[model samples]
Target: MARVYISIGSNIDREHYVTAALDALAGWFDEPLISSVYESESVGFDGSPFYNLVVGVDTDLSVAELSARFKQLEADNGRRRDVPKFSPRTLDLDILTYDLEVGRVDGVELPRGEILKNAFVLLPLAEIAPTAVHPVCGECYQVLWQAYDRDQKLWPVDFTWQGRRISQASAR
Candidate 1:
């Protein structure tokens, strides 16, 4: 099985949607490294605030297969990607890292910018994988996240998904 990290975000039906997505993801992975949920402003386009969290999973599925599975989960949760970038959605699950496999496929890129520049992704990821180094920057996730501007606010919400606790901090 390959180690995979996925970032999950939602702004529509805010809390419920995020919880559902987390539950769905937990069902698929053998051990889900879930991060504490955070609230962040819309990134690329204007929209409602988003609830962002990251989860790391060790899976046997290939990248493409995993992507398809995520898409299916989104569809089930009422995600519509055709709207606009950063628009509100039921769920947004991005494959941040997959066994360090790097390349482009069908216009979507793995190991994308979201993993590095976004605190929403980095902070939670570091929670799950404290020693996990950034594939490109060669720095630990916690250090990288701390180096980013602290001005941006990412608040913890009253949310928890259905799964065994990977860590005490994640448990509600």
Candidate 2:
């Protein structure tokens, strides 16, 4: 099985969709290693705030298959492609890393660019995989996160799943 990390976000009906995403992921793969849910301002567009998090899943699927799966899940959750590239979304799922694979593998970027460019992707990933090394950068996630730019704002929020508290917010 390939160990993979995925980023999940939703700006529309944040709670419901985020929960639904976690549920759907749990159904397909092993129970995921979840990160704290975070609320953050939208990047590249104007829209409502989004709830974002990272999940670790061990799957036998290839990167191409995983990419297709995510797209299907997003569509099922009401994601609209007619909107602009950075417009609001009901659900957004992107593969962050697929095992130790690098560059484009099977049409999917092995290590997603946003993992370093966006706090929404990096923070939660660092939280869950502190010691996991970046395939390209060759540094553990915690170290990369320590050197991250803080201009883009994001914070953890209270989130529950399956009647269990999975994330807790802190005073900002």
Candidate 3:
């Protein structure tokens, strides 16, 4: 089974959609390696804050199949294709990496560009897959996070899933 990482986010009814996504993932792939959820102001558009996290799974599915499944999951959770790309979403799921493969595969870019450009993606990714090397940069996620210099801000939030407290908000 190839290791796959996916980034998940939601702004509209954040908790509900996030939980739904996690539930679906668990049901479909058994237990997943999940990262702490972070809340961040919407990027690229004016909207409510989003709850973002990363999930790691081992699967035999091809990149196209995995991407299709994620797209269907988002659509099931009320994601509107007619909406603008930057608009608030009920659920947003993107394939971040499929093993260590680089470049475009099955029409999806491996090691998604957002991993380096967005705090919401990198921070949680580093938390869950710190030792995993980036396909292109050849740096471990933890090291990349340490060297990240962007001002994009985000913080962990108290979040629960399946009767367990999966993430704790910062005490500040």
Candidate 3 lDDT tens digits, 1-172: 9999999999999999999999988987867999999999999999999999999999899999988998999999899999788899999999999999898999998879999999999999999999999999999999999999999889999999999988999975
Q: What's the lDDT of the predicted structure labeled candidate 1?
A: 0.78
Candidate 2 residue spans exceeding 4 A from truth: none
lDDT of each: 0.78, 0.94, 0.94
User: What is the per-residue lDDT of model 2 for residues 1-172, given as tens digits with 9 covering 90 to 100?
Assistant: 9999999999999999999899999999877999999999999988999999999999999898989989999999999999789999999999999999999898888799999999999999999999999999899999999999769999899999999998999999
lDDT of 3: 0.94
Error of model 2, residue 169, in angstroms = 1.0
The C-alpha RMSD in Å for every predicted model, in order, reads 3.2, 0.8, 0.8
| Pairs that collide, model 3 | none
Per-residue CA lDDT of model 1 for 3-62, tens digit only, reads: 988998998887788878777876877668777878778777778888888888998888
Which window of ten consecutive residues has the lowest lDDT sum in model 1?
163-172
Error in Å for residue 64 of model 3: 1.0
Q: Please report the TM-score between candidate 3 and the true structure.
A: 0.98
